[model samples]
Target: MDMASALASLSRLQHPFSRQRSGWLLAGTLALGAIPALAQSTSGVDGVWSGTAQSNGQQVPLKLEIHGEGDHLQAALLNGKQRSASSSGSYTDGHLALQFDYYANSIDASLKDGTLTGTFSSRGRSIPFTAQRNTKAEPSSPNPVNIGGDWEVEVKSSKNESAWTLHVKQSGPNVEAVIQRIDGDTGSLFGEWRNGQYEVSHFTAAGPSYAVLRPQADGTLQLVTPAHGGTTQTWTARRPQQARAAGLASPDDPLQHTRLSNPSQPLAFSGKTLDGKTISNTDPDFKGKVVIVSIGGSWCPNCHDEAPLLESLYRKYHDRGLDIVELSFEEENQLANPTRLRAMIQQLGLTYQVLLTGTPDQLNEKITGVEHLDSWPTTFFIGRDGRVKAIHTGFAGPATGDAHRDLEKETDALVKKLLS
Candidate 1:
């Protein structure tokens, strides 16, 4: 189906926690009142439903719990094993209208007796979901959107800061693409797209890096920026209107930039906190805490998003002896001065000790070079004994909510192990 319609179908899926968040739900319900509800039928699908979905040749079992009042239909996916991604739509007429974040369109599924026995389309793939209603069954989750094909994507950074042109091809569930730099030389990228989300391992002429994209329902895609840690913008592709091979490639040249690692390299420092508190590598106070040293700036949008999450983690685990030090890269040259650094920390409401690193050039020289740093908001986790644990570069933000979810899961596991 078309992108708009595909998105609508995915939007109909809902989260189980909706009722608990009444304010947000109320606003959404009011805004979405224009959409039609499920069709009025003698089909007794007004309860819990469950089934398996084999879409685009991938099979995933789904459990759906529908709460219907009169003409309105609200359903939640009962399975938490899948990600928390959900949709909202009304069942009206014979069509099941739904919307999802990963599609640029909504989907209209023709259902017979709560079964998706008719045609359905999402992310340019039109397939049938042979759904059957089970009174005692839970709902099944089909994959989100399927952006499985050859695509020519051009990413223009906001305000012409930078741009990347990609010639991406999807083979089955795997993603293999070549990105052309501004000078026309090509670098490679690899990953996969399932349910309309992209987990790409981006490499310039450099080494391994990462990127995630969320396809919207209106055929427009949301580019989850790793730099700013939040939703950035919407992009729509103009597919060639002519008949071409489903997995075809164009001869156009792609844009390129310096290759940087997705997870940037670690930087060492021997500095004090932003509040003029003496904290050096030899400090006895940090002898046994899971420490995190960060390279970030308050002016950076990506850093703004990451700082809050870091603050959340600190608050949650600081009592358990989690020590965090932020190395600030302010616009001023005297950034290493603690008095100036504390102002930046106060402005961001960051309770952690922030040390002023040197100038950006000096900062680059002191830490690993900036060329190795793909984006801002870089983090390096340290073990209790002070050795490096992991380096996470770039912030995917709430736009690619799933990526952040995975990050939280990883962090929790590590923290739990340390606590234990």
Candidate 2:
């Protein structure tokens, strides 16, 4: 694999959740019902095709099979992992139109020679993909982690704190095990694994997701995404001689005090929504219910990881009179504009109210009264009476292995306790 293809392949490994390698998931299941022969003639969509789907920065290769008999057409999408996504629709004029039950999912282009270029909609979001004719193809290389084994790992960061852990496990392709976070929290080793990697979807009282580990080679793990385009970080871990400290305290934990304890201050600015609606401490909705203010930019990958989780939580608890506000510090000036903000809200199918936060300097003043913040994706959870319940400083993306486990545990306990 050249640099570009290697990069693309790496992307696929990261986001197996959405992309389909073969005939997996949505692309495999989406099929257009029926179309008029005249419509097909005009659309000119009669062929086999191939494509890839990209979300944030992760990419998944896909295969599309389109068989159109006159105006009647049938389309099938095969993802990188052999997941199937199929859809059916008719052509009108020169447009090959198809509909996915999910909104954000879209089909990008019409059929062409042995390929179709388009996107699939899911969770009110769209990731571009393509498909090609079905043929016997080579299977993907086996994922690094063995069913049972000890692996060496390390993480070093000059921009942020550096840490290491021994991921002890017993399982295969997917493993079941525990990861020792260098900056461990309470010696609370979360839960058991089902497949191999920690089952982040489930929860235990002890902790959040990091209980499992995804094996990484001794080489540097380069991080890239739409948000931090040119940013890169090198990380590696060594195998431990014996069982290491489980609840080893992070020396830097004390420095985190300032940002984690105080919550009376607001991270958002006083402004109207994109539609020119006013929002502030004086708003009627602000008077009651726990208000959660999130500082993020649409371009951030960490935000992408946390946004969906936040949106899900907000919807689950909003009816209980819970108030959650998003303060987006978008890099796009257009996104900063109220009109563009409105368009983004519609385009992204966001149901929460998002305000345009000022510059980084201004944001410093907004959250200054509390503690200090360094990252772009910080969340401050307020209580029903409008008091700060918790101040979560950063995101633990799915890639982090164990960060997500701890986050969910903290977030769930806090949210449920407040609701009760």
Candidate 3:
């Protein structure tokens, strides 16, 4: 059977959570309306529904675009340029449901008098959600200020203090923004300048994320981002050089953050494939081949982004002695069913060998060869001689623009070097 067909078969394999389906991999589109990459609000219960999910008492901006009506509905969650359409959708009795099967995540709410009130839920965690028709936005500023360029952002919460790079490209009122950290970026966030502040949002099968920014008098930007757990975080951002000059650290290079404990030692690891077959480095498929071993989970968004690239690379170089293996560390429930992992493999058309390891928390403990293995999508390159060559700790996805391209190019070059 074809990949999609196989995925569909696996999806049909029932689970305890009836609402949990591989929504990201399902293929059904409804042309209810058009929500451009950069968009404003529209009227009715079907168009673009915009609002905030309560975050630690703060609000994070989000946009839900729904088209069609009744039993046949097309819906997508919008966050800047990142638009994730529902794999499954329904509308009945003034109630709407959109499920992104990939993460077993769903959004269910009731529509009343042009308003939507409900909750976005995953596993056992639920976040209160409420939105109204995204009304047409009118720029309050006669001259929309330019908040373009690279910004050095600093998050100041009692729990976490980290530095991030914020990239923004603006043309008049439209804006495209993202935050790049040591591990990966937050994907694309598209918004327009409205009122006196800037608002951007992104939602996918992974969940919802929204940020609001206002320029301050001291030439800095006050950033408020609503995150999971119903809590919002306020941060400050300035130019890259300025932040660095003020002692704000830069993001660690992806290739330099994670490394092998012994460069000359061969990576000794093995895990069980879906069907319960154990594959190891000594396997014939891996012996004398240049292998790329990726450590990540199906629930991770960055891993979702990196899977396609890994698949593409494998297809391109597999005949030339390139071998790729993915060690998936998923939730315990997934270990039993693996519907999401199956969907990802089918959606990406990955032909590489995939094995089920433990969970994400078991990463460091399960793999004894590496240090600083904190990132979800770390990649290890093994040379033909069976020695470790290089390790990349994080993923720079397409949403990162040039950085992502550069990483791909660098990887290709490194693989070529290892093969030679």
Top model number, TM-score: 3
* Residue lDDT tens for model 3, 280-352: 8888877789999998877777777788788888988999999998999988999999988887676556788
Candidate 2: RMSD to truth: 12.1
The TM-score, computed over Cα atoms with residue i paired to residue i, of candidate 1 is 0.39
TM-scores, each model vs. reference: 0.39, 0.52, 0.82
Model 3 TM-score on a 0 to 1 scale: 0.82
For model 1, how does the per-residue alpha-carbon lDDT over 181-241 read when each residue is reduced to its tens digit?
2222122234445555764432110111234546666554444322222223343332333
Question: Which stretch of 10 consecutive residues in model 1 shows the poorest summed lDDT?
Answer: 22-31
Q: Tens digit of lDDT per residue, candidate 2, span 1-420?
A: 553344234333432122211001111111121223322332356443433455434343344444444345554432222212232355544456553221123454655564556655543456566554333333223443342433334443332443533343333333333222222221212222233233211111100112223333542221111223423233343344321333222323312533643455444346446666767755767776777787765443345456667777778888886677777664345444444345335433578877766654465665556554655567777776766667666565543455567777778778878777
| Each prediction's whole-model lDDT (CA) | 0.45, 0.44, 0.70
Clashes of each: 70, 82, 16
Worst 10-residue stretch by lDDT in candidate 2? 200-209
